[model samples]
Target: MLYAGTRHRDYTLRVPLAGDLVDAQEAHPQGLVRLVALDLYRRQLLQLGEIPAEAITLELLRSELTEIDMAELERADAELGKRFAPPRPGSSTGAASSTPSSVTATPSPTSGA
Candidate 1:
């Protein structure tokens, strides 16, 4: 999911685990692997000091977890995700588009009367 920060910049944070991570395995064949994966993700986030310990519970961690602590966490996560994940399809990689519309274009210079 993408988060907009205080600076009004859009940042994307991608959770790495794929749907196959939840596939039934001999050790954990009940399809609980996704839960385990989420736990690990939450622990990693906590280790990074992103979300507080109180926010690390299974319920809170499993649910959509954009909390008050997410501003900085989202920023950091976005940076990390950018470094790790491939650029999203059709996403701009360079500086954000700052071009003004044609309606706001400056008038061209003309010869003095």
Candidate 2:
């Protein structure tokens, strides 16, 4: 299912997997959606060989992701049975977040203590 993209699509819009988080952590280091986009498109970019990956900044990709029309993308997300999420870069409040906000960790007692 297509989760995010625009009319003239720049990257593959396939559903992002949970494993993507681990992969994205090493490289993209951006929000899930933007990381997903970069994870999908970075190597294949016609510009990648010309410029090092480090040279590409989050703002550059964010500019591309910010243009996606949320109305259609959000509808597609629902159709795919995905929870609502804003694909806008740096947003992780909803489904875009791999970890639920409701989760709280209680401190575990240390064996040494």
Candidate 3:
């Protein structure tokens, strides 16, 4: 997944985990890995804003996450997913009408509480 940061930022992040993360997100709905990965990617980009394209590496991202941050990231990730995830198949909700909204377009402010 090529994630664009805030709309104002010109850089794009190539998330290597995008495929597996989406798979886990839909398949293992209760898992936190996808959420963690999402938070890590966002933080990595924000922390290193306007850097060279080649500077965005998996190691740099992994280095920023800790076990203590997992709980917060998990919560934020769940909230972000809930707000953005497409309605499940055969569900009855207005969100179903808005399916296919761009998830990788920009980062939203998910309450960290």
Candidate 4:
């Protein structure tokens, strides 16, 4: 339920309150603020306006975390890492690629009889 906005004045990102988010809240109280930075890279929830992570209040987190959907939280956690994943080759858009192509392998030659 917690959200953020970019300085560009384009959109806002909604924080999906999943297990990790709750765990982070319990672990350090201010941990969710860090995750907010990650969410910015992912462009996860673009709606609110433009706000900085340091400005995101813990009180809001406490009030809103429970309201998040359980299923969405699971999805958000699973997809979190994808935010930093590299873009596909020949892709012009800066958006994250649905297809993962971070690595490629080459076959080695073998001796023939």
Candidate that scores best on TM-score: 3
Worst 10 residues of 3 by lDDT: 6-15
What lDDT, from 0 to 1, does candidate 4 have?
A: 0.39
Q: Which has the better lDDT: candidate 1, or candidate 3?
A: 3
Candidate with top lDDT is 3
TM-score of decoy 1:
0.28
Candidate 3: residue pairs that collide: none
Report the lDDT tens digits of candidate 1 across residue range 9-104: 222223444442343233345546555654434433423223444644546544544443344444454555556567799988897569642211
Ranking by TM-score: 3, 2, 1, 4
Query: Model 3 segments beyond 4 Å from truth?
Result: 1-18, 21-48, 65-76, 84-91, 95-100, 105-113
Q: Write the per-residue lDDT of candidate 2 for residues 55-112, one digit (tens) a residue.
A: 4445555454333332333333344334334466876555445655421111122210
Clashes of 2: 0
- Candidate 1 lDDT at 104 equals 14
Instruction: Give the Cα-based TM-score of candidate 2 against the true structure.
Output: 0.29
**Can you write out model 4's per-residue Cα lDDT over 7-93, one digit (the tens) per residue?**
222323333445545554455656456454333323343332344545444454343433223233334434544554566798786
lDDT score for residue 49 of model 2: 18
**Model 4: runs farther than 4 Å from truth?**
2-49, 69-71, 81-113
Mark the regions of model 1 whose C-alpha exceeds 4 Å error after superposition.
1-15, 19-55, 59-66, 87-113
Q: What's the lDDT for all of these models?
A: 0.40, 0.38, 0.44, 0.39
Clashing pairs in 1: none
